[model samples]
Target: MNTTNLIATIALLACATGVFSHEKSPHHAPKAAPMKEQKEWGIAGDVKDVRRTIAIRMTDDMRFTPSAITVHEGETVRLRAQNKGKVLHEIVIGTQAELAQHAEMMKKFPAMEHDEPYMAHVRAGGQGDVVWHFNRPGSFDFACLIPGHYQAGMTGTITVLPRKP
Candidate 1:
């Protein structure tokens, strides 16, 4: 083969064997197995395991209607967020300290993008859901960590009651 053709063939072979591939390339990423992270409140739950769903409303006034929710231990609930205002809103579930820390971080980085199973971002007139299993019985906090939103009292509480004997 000519010199140019030989070089092209070698390049193709190198690429096929990943000799010139970037180790951090997205295509080379390992398959995403389901996350098994167990937070203080609970772990991520599958949709099929959802035993109940609670509808929450978000308005421009930075409030979540029926701000307090109750659930039993070992129950998987789908927390559905409905945004009725003319802006974006989100629900992030975590311990009180975690929520406060995250909200402060968001104030510094307004455009930060964090996608966790415990968070659901909903656009105006749209809806989102977070399926979570409450295995730990405790009172957790949920909030909208969108810059000034959380400071405006855009928060709620989730109470996990102990299961009946």
Candidate 2:
């Protein structure tokens, strides 16, 4: 092949091998802040510190089972999330405003990629989990900020009550 054709062939092969692939899944999120960042919502939890386990099911109907969860302040809950639908799903933990903003960004950038300690992404019939520390007392949100998923109502609440004296 000519010099130009040879270079084009090499570039094509590289692309075919995913050498330049940057596409990402909707579950992709920004790097989670450090555990000691003192978030208004809470922090990532340690598996060993989990006080209990809870299940959150993602359905194709754009819903999450047990739409609300309650936890005590300073508690860590291990969440077992399952995608019972026929599509991809995820559970992203954040405040209502945060989730809403993330969802809007996801809608604009469908292929955004992110992985954090407080997010779980699963395929159809798949399962995932996250350990979260409810260190503060307030209401937070957990939603599937996967493109249209959050807009379709795949959101839940986490109510953290103050710890007893």
Candidate 3:
């Protein structure tokens, strides 16, 4: 092939790979900042470090079973989400302001893909989990930012009580 043809062929191949990318791969445009930075909500925890498991159910009624949860500071808990609804649902742990902002963004980009340690996208009739460490003392927010989900009141609160001195 000529030089130009060779370059064009390579470009086409690259585009084809992008089009058929794997689901777990990060392909969402305009991605968010790296999740490694610790937020006020706390950082991701290792599964082996998780001491407690909280079972949560996501229903089509735009609700999370046991929407309110409490954990002590310095504790690592496993958040297990089972999607009982016939639609996709996700749980993202963040500050109230962060959740609000993300929900607004999701409304604009309904197909935006996110795979952070603090978030879990559970499919209908499927289950997912997020292990998180509560090192901060305060209330945080978790919501399904799937366009109308958050507006329909699919949100929850996580209260991390301060550790007793």
Cα lDDT for residue 3, candidate 1: 73
Best by TM-score: 1
TM-score per model over all chains? 0.81, 0.77, 0.79
Candidate 1 lDDT over residue span 57-142, tens digit each: 99999999979999999999999999999999999999888888778767755776556899998989999999999999989999
Estimate the lDDT of model 1: 0.88
1-165 per-residue lDDT for model 2 (tens digits): 567546645765676565235344445457556554466778888889987999888899999999999999999899999999999999999988888877876775576556677888888999998888888999998999999888888899999999999
State each model's CA lDDT, in order. Answer: 0.88, 0.84, 0.87
Ranking by TM-score: 1, 3, 2
Better of 1 and 3 by lDDT: 1
- State, as a TM-score between 0 and 1, how close model 2 is to the true structure: 0.77
Model 1, poorest ten-residue lDDT window?
15-24
